[model samples]
Structures are given as structure tokens and as C-alpha cells.
Target: MKLKKIFLITVAVLSVFYTIGCWDMVDIDKRFFVGNIGVDRAEDGEQMLVTFTFPIVRKIAGGQGGGQGGGGGSTIVVISTVTDSIHAAARQAAMRLSRRLFFEHTRVILIGEELARDGIEEVVNFLERNTEINRRGRVIVVRGKAKDALTIKNEIEVLLALYIANIFENRDICARFIETDVDEFMKQVHSMNGNVLLPRLTPGKTDVKIGGAAVIKKYKLVGWLEENETLGANFVLGEISGADIMIDIPGYKYPVVFTVTHNKAAMELLEAGDYPKFRVKLEVKGEIVETPEQIQLAPEMLKIIEKMLEDRINHMVLASIRKLQEEYQVDLLGFGEYLSKYKPDVWEEYKKDWENIFPDAEINVETKVKIRGIGASK
Candidate 1:
């Protein structure tokens, strides 16, 4: 009987402890789920304009006579505040909001071009230090003001964040833009010393276009990489999953459309002399999706088509490299990283002055394409 009495007392004590833990817990209904974050440079140039977009819980739940296409307003709400820092902005916004702003569901982070041009160090710091930020969330550089992008009324997806995040799923089909999540962005910034590429978002009337890429060097936005240039860069990076190439044949009235099935890239350091000589070899395999007219699928004709595809790919890859070397004078390619891993000895020699040496380096590109199929037509 005495042992049973002691056990009961211990159980009661543990129950009391568990109950105390819930004392500070806020109810789910009292919190707001932040869907996206936007950062822009304030007009004064001394502070940051931070915007937060979140779904209205009542409207989403259809509690306040609101439906999917209700006439009241958008299902989501957007609030902004100008403060010295992102954290401060959040706190300042809380003064006007009734519920706490929660970021565990944030799906996108948009940085305005104006602020990106000035620098993104502050944004990076906030992403790293904030424990609530989602690491899998995508980071994009908006073409204009982030505020404008965030305010867009997207009707496709229930939430604007979901709409934007889902666009990245099309990367495999279209390689026109660069995709980088918060975690990958952080890793590249550290590994590449603040040289990275992020997707560009262009706001439209009630919609947004995600294409091309924003070039970031030393944590500052330098310029943009066009759709074709981004596609070429993806080839060198071995990131091409699917791309269509149009080759105009002499006889055919229309161009032949080829779809890439597989691609592989190899880099070689032929000579590490005054101007390092490097060669990039690309092996590509694809199929002809469209043909102007039905022609004999002869072995010789296939060979000719293969050569045309090879030339087109070579031109694209080389043009992208040349622009980066001559126009940007920055190496977004993994040449430096490759040397560090494959030829550490050579990297040690050029690591100190690689920025200046890379521009003058001689790079040769070679591409070989094979036609795997001629589509349904004979």
C-alpha cells in the first residue's frame, strides 16, 4: 500500500510539469502563417522596406462567408513596414497586426532589383540568423520593386507563394532560368565567395514571369543572363535535363526541332601556362521532335542532322563563356572549383590572382550530338 501511494505522487508531479509547458503556447488561430517575404530599398536609402504576405485563416476556412472567388477581396493579406532591419520590420508590423507573424510556411523570398544592385549582404545575414526562416524556400531577384511583385493578384493558385514556388518545378522542361533555394544559395555564397546566380521574377498584370537569371558577383547584382545564355550555362554546368533546338535544313521549308534527352560535359586543362588552355567537351543525345517534311531516315541524313545539332550547341556554349569572360569578367562556372578539387597544386598557384587570369584564359569547346530517334515520321 505504501509503495502504491509513492507511485501516484510521482505521476501527479509529472502531470503538473507538462501542464506548465503549455502556459506560454499560443493557439494556432492566434498566429498568422507568412507565405512570402519581400525586401526593397526604402525611398530614403537608409532603411529597408519589408513586406509580408500571408493567407487569411478565416477566409481560407470559409468562416466569414468567404469563398474561393468571393467579391470581398483577396484571400491573402499583404502588410509592409519600413525599418532599419528585417527583424525590426517584423516587430514594427506586429504593432498593427492582431496576431503573431509566423514564417514557418514561407515559400519565397523576393529581393528588389534596386536593393539587389546596392547589395544583398543584409538579406543574407537575416536568412542565416533567423531560425524561423524556411531553408527550402526559393530566393528570387525581382526585376522591379519587390513590393510590386508581392502585390500582384494571382488567381491560379490560392496563395501567391504557392504559385511562385510551383514555377520552379518546370526547370527540367525549361532551362531558361537558374533555380536556387535558401539552403543552396547559402552554400554557394560561402563556397563561391558571394558569386552566385538566382532566378529573376518579372511582374506582369495579375501574373508574373520567371525567366532568365540575375547575375550576382560579390553579393551585388551585376546584370542578367538571357534565356539562351542561361540555357548555355546550364549545359556547361551539366544541368540540362530538357531543351529544344531548332535547326534549319537547306531543303526543308521549316526548321527541324530537336529535343535533348541526355547530356554530359567534361573539362580538361590542356596547359597551365601563362594563359591556361582549357577544353570543354560535350556529349549530347536527343531526338528530332519535328520535321518540315517526311524524308528517308537514312544513316547519312541522320549524321548530317547530328552535325548540325553539334554546331548549334557549340555556338551557344562558347558564346556564353565568352560573354562571362569578356563582358562580365567574372567566372560563374566551376573552373576555379574544379581546379581546387582535381588539381590542387595548380589551383594554389592561381588562387590568389585567378580573377585576372581567368579572363585571359583560352577556352575551347567541342560538342558531339547523336540522333536517337526520328519521331513517328519515317
Candidate 2:
């Protein structure tokens, strides 16, 4: 009887902890899930403007009958507030919102060109410190206002953030745009020099186009690169997985398309001294994707196609390098990184004045292409 009384007391004591209830519990219906965040400079020119986009769960959720005709508005709500900091802006936005703002589902982060040109230190810090945000969240610089990109009416994906995020899945297929997420951007920012390229977003009449790339030097946007230049940059970076080259056949009155099947790049530091000389060799293998009806799939014809592809690839890659060497005077081609790893002595000697020295560096490019096969033919 004495032992039974002690056992009953132990069970009664453990029940109290579970019965206390959750101190941090909030009702699910009282929270909003943020899908995208946009940062821009305020018109007043003294404060930062932050926009938060969240979907109306009931309207977006499948099997729910909600639309403009049903006395409802757009499926997403965008709210903007001007403040000195991101946290402050969030707090200000919460004032008029009936539900608490949550950011665990944020997929895209858009920065206005104006704000990107200024600098993204504070924005980077906020992303780093926010535990709720995923590191895979994409980062883009809008050509104009980031808020406008967030406000776009996307028919493909109900949420604009998801639509923008889905575009990155084609990185391998195009290679014309760099896939930069929060983690990748941060890694580049912490490199030997904070020089990187981020994809540019432009809003159109009926859709948003994601192409090109914004050149960032020392964490500030300096300029932009066109789609061809971006593709050339990708070639030098060895980031090209799949892309096409058009070859104009002589006397065929039509162009033949070559789809890249394999690619490799090699860099040789021929002479390491004041104003070093480097040679880049790019090798590519492709298959004829499109050809004229009368064209014969002969070895000689294939050889001609290969030669043409070589010249075109060489021109494309060299143009990007020259632009970096002459116009931007920035090194996004990993020349500095190559020297730092392979020849630390040279990097140490020129690291201080690399900005000035890179332009003077002699670079030579050589391209070789092989035609592997002709589609549905020899």
C-alpha cells in the first residue's frame, strides 16, 4: 500500500509540465505567409522603402472559389512602408495588417536598380540574420522598381514569387542568366574582391522577363551586360551546360543550328610577371540540330560546320573578356582567382593594384569544336 501511494505521486507530478500549454502558440489563421520581399529607395531620398508580398491563402488554395467577381480582389497583397531599416519597415507594415507577417516561405528577393547601385550591405545583413528565410531564396535586381516586379500579374503561377523562382530551373538550358541565390551571392561578396554578376529582372506589359545580368563591383551595381555578353561570361566561367550556336552555311541560303553537347575550358599562365600573359583554350562538342533539306551530312561538311562553330565561340567568349578588360575594368572572369590559387606569389604581388593591372594583362583565346553527329542522319 505504501509503494502504490509513491507511484501515484510520481505520475501526478509529470502531468503538470504537459498541462502548462505553449507560451509561444499563435492561431494559424492569424498569420500571413510572405512569398516575396522587394527593397527600393524611397522617393524622399532619405529612407528605404520595403515591400512585402503575401498570398491570400483562401483564394490561392485549390478547391476554393474566390476571384474578382466573387467580391474578392487579386490573390496576392503587396504592402510597402518607408523606414530607416528593414526591421523597422516590417514593424511599420504590421500596423495596418490584421495578421502577423511571417517570412518562412519567402522565395524571391527583388532589389531596385537604384538601391542596388547604392549598395546592398544592409540587405545582405538582414538576409543573413533572418533565421526564417531560406538560403536558397533567389536574389534579383529589377531594371526599374522592384515593387513593380513584385506587383506583376502572373498567369502561369498564382504567386509572382513562385513564377520568378521557377524561371531559374532553366539555367542549364539557356546559360544566358546567372542563377544567383542568397548563399551564392554571399559567397561571391566574400571573395577576394566583392565583384559578382546577378540576373536582371524587367517587368513588361504582360509578363516579367528574366535575362542579362547586373555587374556588381565592390558590392555596388556598376553596369549591365546584354544576353550575349552574359552567355560569353558563362563560357569563361565554365557554367554553360547547354546552349545553341547558329552557323550561316555558304550558298545554303539558310542557317544551321548546333546544340552544345560538351564543353571544357583550360587556362594557361604562360608568363607570370608584371602584366602577365594568359591563354584560354575552350573545347566544345556539338550536334547539328537544324539543317537545310538539300544539305548533305558528309565529313567535309561537318568539318566546315566545326570550324564555323569554333570561330563563333571564340568571338563570343573574347567579346566578354574585352568588355571586362576595357569598359568595366572589373575581373569577373576568375583571372584573379586563378592566380591566387595557382601562383600565390604573383597574386600577392599584384593583389593591391589588380584593378589597374588586369586591364593591361595579355589574354589570348582559342576555341576548338567537334561535330559529334547530325540529328536523324550520318
Candidate 3:
């Protein structure tokens, strides 16, 4: 009886420690879930302006049954702070915020064009070092200001971060923008020596537009690749899953629309001379979505359409290549990477002066398009 009593007392004492719950755990209502982060160069030109957007959980929960605008006033709150570093900015914003700012739920990081042009070394460093940030969150360059993009009155989605991140899902149907996450951005920037393409976000009155691409060379924003040019670059990068090409026929009021379903590209080294000669061959398969009225879908007609698509694709790819080579004098198409991986022997000789040689290098493009269907119309 004495031993049994002693054992029961010991068991009761140990259970108290486990039943107290977590000592550092904060209640859900007290924590603010950050949705997006925007970084821009301050007006003073010496500091950074960081903006954070987070949703009000109470408002979101209360407005559940109601429509999009039902959530009290605004479901999210935006806060901005000017500081020398991102971390410092966050700490400074804490002075004004009621709840602690949390970043684990962050969905997107937007960098302003001005800051991007100056250089993204600080931004990159913060992203890499911050353990609370989501690795899969998108990293984008805003056309004008990062704060403007974040402050848009987006009604399509409850949270702006989700609205922006979800846009990448359309990449399968439209290959106009570059989709890169923080993890992939870091890897590419490190591997390519700070030469990478990031998606561009343009703000509007009601909503925002995500298209085109921001060209970054040496971690600095050099220029932008337009929608079509971005599509061409996607082809060379073998990142094209779908695209629409319009072809004009001899006699037609409307042009024929080709929708790409499959795409593959190969790079071949023709010569390793003073300026190396290269050829890019692309094999594409798609279907005709729209055709001119009364147009025949005969076998000969299909061949003609295929030839037109091939020529169109070739032109687009070559135009993008030329722009990068001649105008930008930068290789963002992984040409150097391809050479280093497959043709290491040649890469050794050209890698030293590859920057100067690449602009003058001769590059040819060949495209073959196959039409799988001509839609339901005869």
C-alpha cells in the first residue's frame, strides 16, 4: 500500500509539466500572418522602403459567408518602413503594428524596378539568410514601385499574395512571363553569375498585370523582355509548354491561330572557331484553334500551315536571340550552360572570353511545327 501511494504521487507530479502546454506559444489572434513583402529604394537613395501586407484574421473569418467586399473595411493591412536593411525595416515596423509580423506565410516578394536596377544584392542576401521566409514564394520585379503593386485593390482574390502567386499557374497556357521562386532564383543567380530573368509585375488601377520579363545581368536590372520576346526565350530555354501563334493566309479575313501543345529544343555546336557557330533546332506540336472561314483542312493545306508556323517560330526565336546577343550583349538563354555541360572541351576555350565572343557569335534557328488537330470546325 505504501509503495503504491508513492508511485501514484510520482506519476501525478510528472503529468503537470506536460499539461502546461507550450510556454512560448502565442494565440492565433495575436499573430499577424504576412502575405507579401515589397522592397524599393527610398527617396533619400540611401535607405530601403519595405512594405508588408497581412490579412486581418478576424475580418476574414467574419466575412466568410459574404461576398468578396463583405470583409468589414479592408481584409488586409499594409505597413511600410524605411530602413537600411530588410530586417531592420521589419523591426521598425513592429513599433507601429499591434501584432507581431510573421513571415512564414509570405507568398510573394516584390522588388521595385529602381531597386532592381541599382542592384538586388541586399534583397538576395536577406532572402537567403532569412529562415522564416518561404522558399517557394515568388520573387518579382515591379515595373514602377513595389509598394504600388502591393497596394492594388485586387478583388479577384482575398489576399494579394495569393492572387500574384496563383498567376504562375497560367504558365502552361501562356508562356509570356518568367516564373521563378526564391529557391530557383537563388540557384540560377548563383549558377549564372547573377544573370537571370524574373517575372515583371505591372500595377493597374483595379488590379495588377503579370507579364513579360525583367532582364537581370550581374544582379542588376538591365532591361525588359517583351511578352513575345519572353515567349521566344522560353522556347530556347525549353520552358514553353503552350503558346499561340497567328499566321496570315493568302486570302483570309481572319488569321489562323496555332496553339502549341508540345515543344522541344536542341542546341548544336557547328564550329568552335574565333566566334563559335551554333544552331538551335526546335520541334513543336500544336493544333489550330481558329481558321479563316471556308478554309479547307486538306493534307496539302495542313502542310502549308505547318510551314508558316515553322517560319513564324523561327523568326521569333531568332529575334529574341539577336536582341540578347546584339543589343543586350548578354546570354540569358543558357547557351554557356549548355556548352559547359555537353561540350566541356569547347567551353574551356571560350569560357575565358565568352562575354565578348558571345555578341559576335553566329547563331541559327530552325523550327518544325506539327499540327495535331484543326478544332471541331471543318
Candidate 4:
């Protein structure tokens, strides 16, 4: 009984030792959170930037009208710089900042519209190679100053960094948090004829919103894609499902909107002697989210809606494709990857003359649209 009691006491002591302490715990007070990072194109073809929205012990709002008072005052800071590169900018900008710079907690990275227009690969490549930057961080192309996206605030979110992350994480029309990490982006870049799309952002006087996407071809910012075009691109790339489309019909008081609940698409290459033919097969099913007036879902009306949806999807996809073909001369659709993987023999033949073959390849697209319901009309 004595020996058992002694053993029990020792076990209890050891458990107490293990439970009460953290060996190398990092305190929240000791660290700083990065809200948003900005990048601009320099006159010398380098990157210049200003990182905005730094974290404070307590939340803060700046201005003569706004002072550090009450439970909240000024919790965020804005420190900026014009540097040769992003990492260098971070170090140089840190000199002006009160706290030490760290990227481990950075949630949003914004590239200025100008820098993106010239090319984003230079900056993005640096981001990818850096060991501190994680693949999960959300990236955006800015319409104006990248810093403004971070600094504009009057108590909208507790922390602008988190708010930016939440917008990209989940929620609304013109909202797509579709996962596009650094790895996948680089994969598309490395592919010989692959293209990539980056979600874009814009800051208004009141709020910020998703501003479509930037299309990248061969690691270069070829152009910008509108909302409808991005929807079509998502369909082509199979990046999303359950999206909505609004179409304005003549004589109709309001635009007819369709909420696409299901979509699947694939492309196949057919041999055509010295050349090859391409077939794009797409299947889409959607619910009638909103329709102004009593536009009944009659057979004819449904057929017309189907045709409309098909035309919309097709037009957007074709426009993007043509942009890639004529103006950009780069494929973001991974058509080459598809060929390389499935049709090895064709890839072997086409690889030799892909540039010559792509423009001349006969391409066809077929779409099937199904309208599941007409809301209350059902």
C-alpha cells in the first residue's frame, strides 16, 4: 500500500509539470500582425511599395477628429517606402516603423495596377521563393495604390487584415474565394502553354470589392478579365460551381438572372490529318434566381433561356480564348497540359510545332444548359 501511494504521488507530480507551462510560447503582445502589403512599378523597372495597416496593442483610428481614446483609439499604423524589391522594401520600410517587421502573419498582398500591368511575375516570383511567405496568403491585383487598400478605414473591421481575409474566404455576388495558392499558380506558369488568373480588388470611398481578375500568360500580365469573362474562365477551368449570371433581355423591365448550380466542362483534341481539331463540351444546370414580371418558364421560354445561357457562356469563353490567341498569344486554359497528359502521342507531334498548330487548330464548343426551377413560378 505504501509503495502504491508513493507511485501515485510521483505520477501526479509529473502530470502537473507537463500541464502548466509552454516551452517556447510566443505571446500576442510580443508580435505584430501585417495587414496589407503594396507594390508599385518604379521608373527604373523595379518595385516600389508601402505596407499599410499595422497592428497595435489596441485598435486605433487616425485623424484630428479621431484620437486614441475609449476602449479603442488608433490600433493600426501605416508605414511605407519606395524600394528596389518587395523584400528589400520590407527591410527599408521597417526602419520607419516602430515594431520589427515580420511576414509570418501577413494575410493580404496587393500589387499595384501599374506593376501588374507591366508584369507581376517579378514580384510574385520573389514572393514564392521567400521562405517566410506561405502558400495560403490571399493575393490581389489593385486598381490604384496598393497601400490605399490597406490604409482606408473608419472602424469597418476590427482589423483590416482579417477583414480582407474574410472577404476572400467566404461570402456575395462578385465574390469568389476559390482557392488559388502559390503552388498551383507556379505550376500554371511552368507549363509551356498554360495561363493563370488572379482575383482583383478595388477600394471605393466607402468599401472595398472584388474587381474581377488579372489574366497571366507565360508569367506576364496579359490583360484584365471582367466579371462575366471570369465566370466563363471559371467554367472553362472548372474552378467553381454554383455561380449566378444576370442577362438583360430586350423589352424586359429587369435583367433575367440565372444561378448556376452545376457546371462541368472538358476539351478534347481530334486528329485531322496534318492538323488537329478541338472540341469543347460543357454541361451547365442552374436555378432561376430572379426574373422580373411573370415570365413563365414555358418550353419556348426555357429553350430561349437555355440558348441565352449557352450564348453567354460561349461568348465569354471565346472572347477570352481569342484574346489569348490573337492579342496575348498565350494559353491560360492549360490546353497544352491536357494534350501533354492524355494524348501523349499528339503532344509529341504538337510539341514540335505548338505555336504554328495552335492558331490553325479547328476548335468547336458545345454547351448544354438546364434550368432547374423558376423560384416561386415552380
Candidate 5:
């Protein structure tokens, strides 16, 4: 009888397990996966113009619908809607899309220049609150219309989002563009006193260029950093992985290119008085990539080359700091953070007015370069 009871219990458990069904499961074929999202200012000046790019999975999987439409079978489709909030914009887009919209696959988020300048607090809040959106989604500010970037004809990647997303893969090679994600930006906005640097993307004919950066001060876009300026900021932040430096050789009329192999920067608080002073020292190691004519790879010659590279780096670093001090007056270089961490007493006095005091602070840059190798002896 006990054996019979055990057999009956086993059968009942098996029946319960087999009877369960996917009550809340949604089919993959019934959803539109968003690859990219663009946010801009609406024509009404009050609402937001949101753009969504959805990739056609059928064409991507080499099934059908390859170049069948008027535009010759595009890989992705872009749709725009005007709404007061991101959620509202998503709902508005759903009215036209044949399938349910999904954001779990989103790779990039582009913000229009005007909208970024006005402020990105609302957009930041939306991304932070949305659980469906991936935290790794890239965040960038487009120089012009964000929608323009979304509509670009990308021949490299099937989706423009992937094209933009792949640019950061080579960040270690140049360090001109920063990779800012949704979570990273939100953390900076909340912890950095609303100061952050977001990568800048400019759309071109049939392509898009991701370089430089947009400077955000107090949660508003104040200005932009060119590629060189961006590199300078990276130097101060000690984020430089590799970069190329071109300097005019002393006697030669042509410029010699030095490819940085290693780079580091150190900050020293010289004084913590009413007018704090700081000194930044940058150490760089590079290899000669290109040189004009027959150049001697002697120690003395390397010294001259090293000095020239040092001066050039000093100028670039100063130019970046000048823009921050005079043009934007924003400390996006972590000068305030440094003071707060090392010299807390000094920071306490200037914490209330760091923005104003930062402009008056004395900061200096010093660079040292070592030429390790000259490619191939003649």
C-alpha cells in the first residue's frame, strides 16, 4: 500500500509540472527590438521629439525582404514621435509599429545639440527609472539633429546603433572620445555636482563620426571639446592609453610623428591657501612612427625630440585648461574632486563657491617624454 501511495504521488507531481503553461510569455517574432533612440526638441518647443530605430531581424538573419522596398530593402527603420515624456513617446510609437516595442536591445542614445544645451535632466531621469532599457546603452550628444544620426545610411553595420557603438572599441588607441553609458552618466550627474563630459557624435554623408566631447556644466551643455582638447582632458584625468604627437623636427621642415606607448599624469597640491595652487606632471613614453629624411636615433637626438614633444603636450594641456577656466569656468577635470579628497580643509572653504574659485586657482602643467624606439634603422 505504501509503494502504491508513492507511485500515485509521483504521478500527481508529474501531471502538475506538465500542466503549467507560459501564461505571460511573449513571442520573439511579435516584438520590435529597438536598436537606437534619439531625443530632440519638438517643434512645439514644449514636447520632446523622440526617434526609435528598429532593425528588421528577417533581413539580418538572411531570410527575406532584402532590398525589396523603395529604398532598396533597408536593414533598419526609424520612427519619430512628439510627446511630453519618454514613456509617452514610446506609447505614441506603438500606435504605428506593427509589433510591440522592446528596448532591451538598445545600443545607443543620441541627444540633439539644442536639447542637450537646454538640459538632459528629464532624459537622464527617464533612463534611470526604466528597467527595460539596458544599462550599457551608450549616451552621446549629436552636434545637430539626433534624428539625422539615426537616419544615416550605414554600409558597415546593419544598424546605425552598432556602428556608433563600435567606435568605443578603439578608444584605447586614440582616447579622443569617451564612452559614456546610461548608468555612468547618471552616476556622474548625481555625484559630480551635475558636471560631466559626454561623447559627441556628428553625422556625415552616409556615415557618422564619433570624436571629441560635449561639456556639461550644472546639467546643461555649456560648450564642446575638440579632439585635441578632449585628449588634453584625458591626460589630466589620467585616462590616456595611447595617442600620436606630431612635432616639427628642429632642422627638418617636415613634422615627426611620435606614437605614445605609455602615459601618466600626477597632480600635486602646492598650496592649500586662499588661492590654492596645483601642479600637474605628465610622463609619456613613445616610439617614432614617421620621420623626414635620414634621422639619427642617438641619445642626444632623442633628447631634442623628447623636449619638443613635452612642449607640445604642455601647450595642449594648457589650452584645455584655459577653455575650462575662461570659456566654460567648469571643473570637469576633477580638480574639485582632487581638492575634496586630499585637501578637505581647503575644499570646505571653496566648496560653496568652487565654480567661481576654480577660475582663480593657479594650475600648471609639466610634461616629460621618452622616445623608446625609432621604427626600423635605415
Candidate 6:
């Protein structure tokens, strides 16, 4: 009887605390949904332009509302202003908005081209210090206004913010390039090497949209990888997961498209004191998806396709390596990290002239792609 009475007393006290305390205190009507954030430098000194994307939640429905063509029905509201800091801007937006702005669900953060060209260190510092933000969020570079990109709502998604988020999952679109996450970019920035990459989204006047991976050197925006160049970037870095390539097989007038389902890259570090040369051995295996040019499915056709695929992959990989090594002068591939672990003393010396040596360093790319049949049919 005494134990029962004590249990009842505890339950009663806990229930009262839960009901009266801060539990579920935030009012839904007083909340502004934050789907994306865009950061750039303002015209004023010691200021920043922060843009937030707000979704019109009323347009969204349940059940039939979430079908493939359903979700992208809502509209997006973009607010941009200059503030002393990000938090200050957040506070200002909150005051102007009907409800407090909530950011726990932000899908992406965009950095404008102007800001990227100016060096992303200060902006990155702000993101890192904020306790609410993490690295899983995808980061992208906008050739134009980052805020304007968030305002775009033409894509087919349940939400405008989600539509932009889906752009990051485009493996078929940019299979070769690694879809960089916020955390991954931070890891690169934290490293002394400062090699990072982000997807660049170019929104169109109509409903058209184009996205490709952009390479960023330690603090500065260097260049970009388009179409096949993006594929080569993947091959050289060994970040290939699932990519498709079109090659012209011998004896066949048209080209065939093959999808690489699995691939692995093996790196071999050479002896020290040399210009840090490394061998990249690429192994790719995939089945054919389409072939407009068919010369009959003979052993010769298969062999030719295999050889062509290997050559193209190798070419693209080498091109990416050459561009990174010769043009951008950024070690976004983490080659320096590989060298440091395998050859520490060498990295210590090479560290000083890394920017100088990056272009001159010799990178040998050897690739082998096995082209399987075009499924059951051609």
C-alpha cells in the first residue's frame, strides 16, 4: 500500500511538470519554416548578406499530395538583408516574419559567386560556430545570387527547398563527381591542404536548371568541372560509384551508353625525394544500358567497347588530374593527405611548396573498364 501511494505521487508530480513546463511550448502559427540559407558579403564593411527561404506550408497536403508530381506545389519566399552577423540577421528576419524563423530543417546553403571568389573562410567560420548547423547539409556555389536560386520553385518536388535538396542526389547526372556534404567540405577546410569541392547550380530563366561540381582551392574558388570533365574528376579521385559513359565501338556506326555499377581505385605511392608521383589503378565493371550503334553482339564488339570505355575513362581521369595538377593549383583530391600518411617526412618538406608542386607533380592514371552486355536486349 505504501509503495503504491509513492508511485502514484511521483506520477502525479511528473505529469504536472510535463503539462505546465516548456514541453511543446512553441506555437506553430508563430513559426517561419527555413528551408535554405544563402550567405554573401554586403556592400557595407563588416557586414553580411544572409538570405532565408520560407516555404508556403499551406500548399502542401497529405496522401495524394506527395506523389511524384505532387510535392513541388508550394511556393518559396526569399528574404535578404545586410547585418553585422548571421545571428543578427536571423534576429532581424524573425522580427519581420510572422513567426520565429526555425532552421533545424535547412536542406542546403548556397554561397554566391561573388562571395566564393572573395574566399569562403569567413562565411564557413560563421557556420562552424553555430551549434544548430552540422556538416551533413549539402553546400553549393551559385554562379549568380545565392538568394535568387532559393527563390526558384519550378522543379518537381513536394517542397521548393526539397527540390533543391534533391539536386544533390543526382548520381545519374554527375556520377563521376563526389556529391560533397557540409561535413566533408568542413573536413577539407580544416585540413592544412584546403582542398574542397561543391556542386554549382545554374538556374534558368524558364524552368531549366543545370548543376555541376565546382572545385574550390583552400579559401578561393578556382574553376568547375562540366559534363565529361566532371566524370574525369571522379575517375582520378577514385570517387566513382555509379557512372555511365557513351563510347563508339569499332565496327559500329553509333555509340553505346554503359553504366558503371561498381568501381575501385588503388593508389601506389612511389619512393621519396621524387616529385610525389603516385599510380592510380582504376577497375570499373558495368552493364550496357543503351547502344544506338550496334555491330551485332559478337566477341569483337564486346572487346572493342571494353577498350573504348577504358580509354575514355583513362582520358577523363588524366584530364581531371592534369587540370587539378596544372590549372586550379588546388589539391581538392586529398592527394596531400595520402602522401602525408605514407610519406610523412616528404610531406613536411613538400608542404611548403605544395601550391607550387601541385601543378608539376606527376600523376599516372591507369584504368580498366569491363563492359558487360546490354542487358537481355540491345
Best by lDDT: 3
Residue range 1-378, candidate 6, lDDT tens digits = 999999999999999988877675677666777788898767663467899887766555342465543545446678888886677888988777777787777778888777787788876786788777655777888877786676664647656667777765767545744577777777777885456877777766534244556777777788887757777777656666677788875566777888887788877776455477777889988888778633456677788778888888888888877877777877766678777887787889888888887677778878887865568764
Clashing pairs in 6: 71-157, 71-158, 72-157, 72-158, 135-183, 325-359
Estimate, for each residue in 277-305, the C-alpha lDDT of model 4 and write its tens digit. 87778888878878878566678887898
RMSD for all candidates, in order, please.
Answer: 2.4, 3.0, 2.8, 5.3, 3.2, 3.9
Clashes of each: 0, 0, 0, 7, 2, 6
Estimate the TM-score for candidate 2: 0.91
Alpha carbon lDDT of each predicted model? 0.89, 0.85, 0.91, 0.71, 0.87, 0.74
Q: Score every model by TM-score.
A: 0.93, 0.91, 0.93, 0.81, 0.92, 0.86
How many backbone collisions does model 4 have?
7
- What lDDT score is found at residue 58 in candidate 2? 77
Tens digits of per-residue lDDT, candidate 1, 152-228, equal 88888888999999999988878788988999999998898898889999999899989988989999999988889
RMSD of 4: 5.3
* Model 6 alpha-carbon drift over 4 Å, by segment: 1-24, 43-46, 62-74, 206-210, 250-253
lDDT of 3 by residue, 32-89 (tens): 8898999999999978999999998777777785655483688889999999999998
lDDT of 5 by residue, 1-378 (tens): 999999999999887767764554569999999988999999887789999999888777663444443354787989999998888998999899889889999999999999998999988888999999999999999999999998887788776788889888888788887777888888888878788999999999899999999999988999899999998888888877778889886678878998887888888889877777989999888799888876767788888888889999999999999899999999888888888898888889989988888988899999988888898973
Model 1 CA deviation exceeding 4 Å by range:
1-24, 63-69, 294-296
In the predicted model 4, the residue pairs found to clash are 59-75, 60-73, 60-74, 60-75, 61-73, 61-74, 195-332
Which should have the higher TM-score, number 2 or number 6? 2
Which 10-residue window in model 4 sums to the lowest lDDT?
170-179
**CA lDDT, candidate 1, residue 294:** 54
Name the TM-score of candidate 5: 0.92
At residue 156, what lDDT does model 1 achieve?
89
lDDT of 2 by residue, 42-141 (tens): 9997688999999888776642543433345688899999998887887899998999888878899998999988997788888888887889999898
In model 5, what is the error at residue 174, expressed in angstroms?
1.7
